[model samples]
Target: MNVLRVAVSAALLLSNAFAAAVPSIKYCQNPRAVNTDYVGRDKNVLVQYTACDGVATTQIARAIEARQSNNVCGAPYNTSCFTPSGGGPDPNDCHVITDALLYDSQNIGALFTLDPAQNTSLITMTYQSCESFMVNQDNVALTYCRTDWASILDNLAFNCQATQNAHGGLSVATDQEWFIQVQHS
Candidate 1:
């Protein structure tokens, strides 16, 4: 009986140690536009935001929260969705747009900033419906500054527009596009 008790206690201690060593997994709904029929023929209009390397989903949520708190129509303009708390365009987070082609592909917006001192970078990409503006009707523009690429902004703009156009017209049959921008300092 004493040996049985000792074995059980050892098992419990080992289980507790293992549990303490495991990191928790958490998921947050991304604020980007998503397609309802992403898995089928009639795609809906909801997009999910994903985290980049060295960045956490919680950080992205915080950034969304920050942007939403400051502006009524912040990025990923999902009025019906909830914004993340304690994160928004801060120095520690990087943002990207997940669904830019659902509406007017030309109006997607994103911002990127890097702070070498803190070893952190922040990116905020907005996937909103583009208004009917005459100028630059087909082009989605973004400003980017990077150490390796002098024309990073131009590259980002080109990439964003191309991705948007690749969706082939905003319809139920099209797949979603993700426009990403990166900054290193």
Candidate 2:
């Protein structure tokens, strides 16, 4: 009886620990689409719609590729061009469709918007809650770290949050401050 009780307690503890380790989803803005028109002249371009967390990067990449190639055209028909790639989409090629194709930047601030419905599978990097640890119970530190589980959670959370709010009728707004810098400078 004693051994069985210990085993049950250990199992319960392990279960809780595993649950805690599972990361939660967090919304992340799409990275700015850098205009790859010229090297060292990367500029942020405005987009009509923003990508959603539920969308896959590969899908977005495929869509952009099709659009660029002009293999697909029209509204509803053209929309199919943005389908996620079944094989694998190159992250480098996936970008926002503006006046022209642009490169993707890591900086979240640089992200442009894309039509979530049209490009239902294009999302930027996933986000996780920043973690911190105390040193000697006197100092605290926080850092945003990436984990596979965390990335999945962030994507789920972002999708849920976006869906709950206005049924996913969200729009991407360019940071006016950042735009000013790019425009003036």
Candidate 3:
């Protein structure tokens, strides 16, 4: 059984990414078309028509591997995408879980708005968070995602009480602010 499993795993990885791997936690390549699209190699660009939470739109572009690539033209590839508690491999900003694609681009523009507070504020290289230790005594951590050229801030906020309890009863306050200077190439 172990031998069979190993062989299967190796074969899949071998057949996986012949082209440049997309900055995706998980992805499938389309072999027939330009070899890759939002859907898959040569697959139809599926879209789902749904109303936005508070925004309304009149049109959206046809779903396709954005031709004429430039800066920020490809899908948002954030390896540091979030995982909801207890959920496996949460789809971050640029990743799409199977069956999550829509039927068309008629309403996708509505999904493009950026909240100044949550989306625009810049982060430093040494960002800090205490929310995890504060709530469940879990240590806070930060990492960079080369996939999307983005910084991932996880478990923000601090709780001194939870930190002390989680770390052998030593009172430790998570610094409210920190820096994470990212050098883009």
lDDT to native, each model = 0.21, 0.20, 0.19
TM-score of each: 0.17, 0.14, 0.16
Q: Least accurate stretch of 10 residues (summed lDDT) in model 2?
A: 176-185
lDDT value, candidate 1, whole model = 0.21
**Which candidate would rank higher by TM-score, 2 or 3?**
3
lDDT tens readout by residue for model 1, 1-185: 32223222322322221121111112211211121112111232222212213333246555454233121112221001012222112112111122223221323333322221121121222222211000000011222222112122223333333223221011010111111222111
Highest-TM-score candidate: 1
lDDT of 3 by residue, 1-185 (tens): 32223222322322222322111111112212122223322233221111112121223431121121112212222111111222111122112211122211223321221111111111111111110101101111212122212212121111112232221111111332112111110
lDDT tens digits, residue span 1-185, model 2 = 32223222322322221122211112212422222122111443222112223423356555464233221111110000111222211212221111122123233322232232333112222101211110000011111112211222222223323223311111111211000000000
Model 1, position 149, has a per-residue lDDT of 20
In model 3, where is the ten-residue run with the lowest total lDDT? 129-138
How much does candidate 2 score in TM-score? 0.14
Cα deviation in Å at residue 96, candidate 1? Answer: 16
lDDT of 2 at 94: 20
